[model samples]
Target chain A: DVKVTQSSRYLVKRTGEKVFLECVQDMDHENMFWYRQDPGLGLRLIYFSYDVKMKEKGDIPEGYSVSREKKERFSLILESASTNQTSMYLCASWTSIRDEQFFGPGTRLTVL
Target chain B: SQQGEEDPQALSIQEGENATMNCSYKTSINNLQWYRQNSGRGLVHLILIRSNEREKHSGRLRVTLDTSKKSSSLLITASRAADTASYFCATEIGSARQLTFGSGTQLTVLP
Candidate 1:
């Protein structure tokens, strides 16, 4: 089974604070993605990495960044957490040969 | 802008009933996929239907794709309370290798 694990299930941060959400996939997939889910907006990608050291911006990359130093781990960085930035963050990984994306159990961040 | 949009943002049904959700996308796609998510958890891949394929089935889940209309539908047969969850449709474009997801349909199955 493919397993994707996120560093936190819930997080609380003050405005202007930097936040880091970590994700690791055991399947060794080549592609890793970070997305945020809002009530009515659904899940929108913030950033994605096709391979280690290679990253691409997704639809909503503002106020967020990603790092993939190794193939199995991908991290999402919030430069400055704001109240509007509070939401459920999800991480996913997929292999080059397959289209299925396995997702980690999300991280719910609350900016206070 | 979101590439796909699912209809009937919310659906409620009784146990043992059939539930269907529709998804429409704005562009040509290599394939369309359906995923299920329980509240506050990760999304689970349900099924995938290629552009060329009109219909596909997995256990109680059935998916249909129409390349001409750029639309797809997922039907869950004999739904149970355990089937209550949010369903999303994802579209894969050429070479992007990334899936674009719609907001999702919230399903409620009552016993």
Candidate 2:
């Protein structure tokens, strides 16, 4: 089974603070994605990486960025956290061979 | 923009009963997939039905797809309390690697 792990399951930060969320996958999937899920809004893509050092913005990438320094690791960074940034963040890894995506437990961020 | 929309945003049923949820998408898709998410957790893949296929089943879950109508339905039979969760339908459109997800249906299986 593919296992995706997120650095933190819960986090709290003050406004204007920078935050980092890390995700690691045991399987060497070529694609990784970051999404923020909000009530009524569902899951909106934030950023995705197809390979190391390559990243693309998704639907809602403002105030957020991503890094893929290694094949197994992907990171999401918030340049300046705001209260509106509070959301449940999910990380997923997928490979071409499988149609399904393996997801991490998710990180619930609270920007006060 | 949201590509898929699920009908009956919320559903409640008693255990041993069957629950059905429907999903409708806007564009052509290579495949449609269903996922289950427990409260405050990430989603788990449930089933994937390609555009070429009509129906598929896993365990007690049955999924049916109709390309002409651009809609799909998921039926969970003999539901248990453990089946309580948020169910989402996602679409893989064209050659896009990412999936567009619907808002999801909250299913509560009462014991």
Candidate 3:
């Protein structure tokens, strides 16, 4: 079974503070993604990494960036956390076999 | 955004019954996938149907995809209380590594 693990299950930060959400996958998948899930908005992609040091902006990339220094780890960074950024963040990894992704348990972020 | 959009935002059904959800997208896709998410948990992959395939089945779950119409449907048969969760449809376009997801349909199976 594939396992995708997030660094934090929950987090709280003040406005304008820097925040980081980490994700690691044991399967060494080539595709990793970060998304924010909210009511009525579904899972909107924030950023994705296809390979180490290669990143692409998804539909919703404002105020957020990502890092993929290694194949197993992907990190989401908030340059300046705002109250509006508070939401459940999910990380996912995919391989070529199924094209279906395995997701992390998600981190509920609260930016006050 | 070329994301899939699911119909019927919420659904309630009695246990042992079947539940069907539909998803529509705006562009061509390489494959469509279904995922289930329990409250406050990560998503679990249910099934995947490629663009060339019309229907596929796994256990009690059935998925159908129509590339011309850019729509898909997922059916869960003999659903139990444990089957209750938010179901989402995701589409992976050709050459795109990321899957764009739809707003999920929340299903409640009553015991």
Candidate 4:
């Protein structure tokens, strides 16, 4: 079974504070993704990495960044957390771009 | 990821009945995929259908794609209470690596 683990299930952060959400996948997948799920916005891609040190901006890359120093772990970083950025953050991994993505449980972040 | 739209934002049905949801995209896609997410949880991939293919099935789930119309539908037959979840349709365009997802259809299968 493919297992994806997130650093936190729920987190609270103050405005202007930096936040780091970590994801680790047991499967050696080549592609890792970060998405934020909102009520009506669906799952908007924040960033994705296809290989180590390789990253691409997705539809909503603003106010956030990502790092993938290794194949199994990916991280989403908020430079300065804001209230508007509060949402459910998810991390996923896939062996290939065309393959199914396995996701972590998700981290619900609240920015005050 | 090509931004796709799913209709009937919410659906309610009894167990043993079928639940159908539709999706439409604006751009050419290499494939269309469906995923299910339980409340407050991450998504699980349900199925995928290539643009060239018209239909596919897996277990109790059936998927149909119409490339000409840039649309797709997912039908969950004989659904059980455990099948209650939100269903999302996502489209992946050729040469693109990310998936653009629809808001999703909230499915509630009652006992």
Candidate 5:
């Protein structure tokens, strides 16, 4: 079984604080994705990396940035946390051969 | 932009009854996939249906796709309490490696 793990399951931060969310996948998948899920909005892609040091913006990448320094690790950075950024963040890793993504448990972020 | 939109934002069904959810999309797609998310958890991939395939089945879940209509349906036979979760429809467009997801349908299975 492919296991994807996030650095934190729950995180709380104040407005203007910098936040970092990390994800690691054991399968060494080539593709990793970051998404923020909100009520009524579902999951909106923030950023995705197909390989280390390569990133592409998704539909909603305004308040977020991503880093894939290593193949097994992907990180999401919030330049400055805001109340509006409070939502569930999910990380997923995928390989073309499987045609499916394996997701981490998710990080529920709360910005005060 | 969201590629898929699921109908019936919420559904409540009793165990042993069938629960059906529908998804509609705009534009052309290479494939459509379904996912299930438990409360406060990451989503789990349920099934995937390609543009060339109309129907596919896995265990108790049956998925059907109609490219002409750009719509799909997921039917879960004999619902169980454990099956209660939010279901989402995702579309893979063109050669994009990422998928666009729908808002999702919240299904509650009552015992």
Candidate 6:
């Protein structure tokens, strides 16, 4: 069984504050992704990393950044948090040969 | 920016009834996948159907992919109250390994 764990389950931050969301996967998957889910928008990709220190911008990557310091860890960073940045963030990892993805329990961030 | 579109944005069915959901994509895909998410939780993998395959089943969930039509369908038989969740269909383009997801269908299985 694959396990993806997020650093925080729920977080609240004031406007203009810096925030970081961490994710780690037990499985040695080669691909990792970050997404923000909204009510009507479904899941919008924020960023993704296929290898260490490598990253690509997804559909909605303007207000966020990501870091892949290690194969098992991926971190999402908000340069300066705003109220509109509040969302449920999810991290997922998948192997090169497999089509299935393992997702971590999401982090619900509330930017006040 | 959405690649896949799911029909019937919402569905309501009684327990033990079968529920079917449809998804259509714009571009050619290597594979199609179905995922389920309970309220306020992370998405879980359900099934995956490759381009060459038409239909596949896992437990009570049946998935069919029609490459010619660029569409797919998922059927859940004998749904239970625990089946009340949002179902989404995703498409993986040639070698990207990234999935483009559609707006999910909200399913409510009344018990």
Q: State the fnat of candidate 4 relative to the true structure.
A: 0.76
A27-46 per-residue lDDT for model 2 (tens digits): 89999999999988788999
Q: What is the docking quality class of candidate 1?
A: high
Which residue segments of model 6 deviate by more than 4 Å?
none
> Cα miss at B8, model 4 (Å)?
0.6
Query: Which has the greatest DockQ?
Result: 3
Q: What residue runs in model 4 are displaced by over 4 Å at the alpha carbon?
A: none
Give the distance in Å from residue A100's predicted Cα in candidate 3 to where it truly belongs: 1.1
List the global CA lDDT of all models: 0.95, 0.96, 0.94, 0.93, 0.96, 0.94
- State the DockQ of every prediction: 0.87, 0.87, 0.90, 0.73, 0.87, 0.83
Candidate 2 residue runs with Cα over 4 Å from true position: none
Model 1 achieves a DockQ score of 0.87
| Tens digits of per-residue lDDT for model 3, B9-99 | 9999999999999999998888899999999999999999998999999999999988888899999999999999999999988797678
Model 1's C-alpha root-mean-square deviation from the true structure amounts to 0.6
The residue-by-residue lDDT of candidate 4 on B13-77, one tens digit each, is 99999999999999889889999999999999999998889999999999999999999999999
Off by over 4 Å in 3: none
Tens digits of per-residue lDDT, candidate 6, B15-80, equal 999999999999999999999999988999999999999999999999999999999999999999
| Candidate 1 lDDT over residue span B1-111, tens digit each | 798899889999999999999999999999999999998899999999998899999999999998888899999999999999999999999999989999999999999
Arrange candidates by lDDT, descending: 2, 5, 1, 6, 3, 4
Q: Which pairs clash in the backbone of model 1?
A: none
lDDT by residue for model 6 (A40-109), tens: 7788899999999999999999989999989999999999999999999999999987779899999999
Share of reference contacts kept by candidate 6? 0.68
Q: Which runs of model 5 end up more than 4 angstroms from their true locations?
A: none
DockQ of 3: 0.90
